[model samples]
Target: MKNEELRIKKSGFWLLASGFWLLASGFWLLASGFYILASGFWLLASGFWLLPPTFILHYPLLIIHC
Candidate 1:
């Protein structure tokens, strides 16, 4: 029972961390997209690095938000 509780706690922590990372990535991607549009190479590079996770997170929201 104690082990089960520990596992649950760990799982919750991971979930929270994952959510934070996803949000951070989304912000980074948004910033990157703006930079790329403005033709800033460093921003474009940063955006490219951020793109995959942003794309993953953004797709679902696009359908829902729009």
Candidate 2:
């Protein structure tokens, strides 16, 4: 009887730990996804102005080497 009770308690502890772990991981993933989505929208909104400096001219790389 005592061994059975100990086994139940151990199992309960692991179940609770796993539940919290899953919730935390889910929340972290959700928040990270939201951030990336927002960043993508912001870049898209400013893409015309942002594009030349970021990719077109490569001016920064040239300046760095010079």
Candidate 3:
């Protein structure tokens, strides 16, 4: 249970962090008009670093509000 909780937290953190990165990259791409490089960063920030361990580790990713 403890390990599961930890994994969940880590996944959530990564999800949020990557989401922010994705948003920032998108904004930068628009502001600077840099499509190619910014698109690469956007793709990576969207899922490349956020999806693998979150799903492959068998931890169900969920959002709960308190």
Candidate 4:
């Protein structure tokens, strides 16, 4: 009974540890996902902001060609 109790306690400890790590990894993934999404939006916004300057610089070329 002593050995069985010890084994059960060890199993419980492992279960708790695994659960903690699982929760930690879940939060890490969520944070990274949010970061990726935010960076995607930032890149999209920056692309739009660059368009006007690009168009202005190339406006004469476009008009001459047209």
Residue-wise C-alpha lDDT for candidate 4, range 1-66, written one tens digit per residue? 999999999999999999999999999999999999999999988987888887877978999999
Best by TM-score: 4
Query: Tens digit of lDDT per residue, candidate 3, span 1-66?
Result: 999999999999999999999999889878776667798789977875677775645543343321
Candidate 2 residue-wise lDDT, 1-66, digit = tens:
999999999999999999999999999999999999999998876875766655646766888889
TM-scores, all candidates, are 0.57, 0.67, 0.49, 0.76
**For residues 1-66, could you state the per-residue lDDT of candidate 1 as single tens digits?**
999999999999999999999999999999989977877877777877887987867878999998
How many residue pairs of model 4 clash at the backbone?
0
Give me the overall lDDT of model 2. 0.89
Each candidate's lDDT (Cα)? 0.90, 0.89, 0.80, 0.95
Question: Could you tell me how far off, in angstroms, the CA of residue 23 lies in candidate 1 after the best superposition?
Answer: 0.5
- Of models 2 and 3, which has the larger lDDT? 2
Minimal lDDT window, size 10, model 1: 39-48
Q: After superposition, how far is residue 54 of candidate 1 from its true place, in Å?
A: 44
Cα error, residue 27 of model 2, in Å, equals: 0.2
Superior candidate under TM-score, 1 versus 3: 1
Candidate 2 vs candidate 4: the lDDT winner is 4
Pairs that clash in candidate 2: none
Best by lDDT: 4
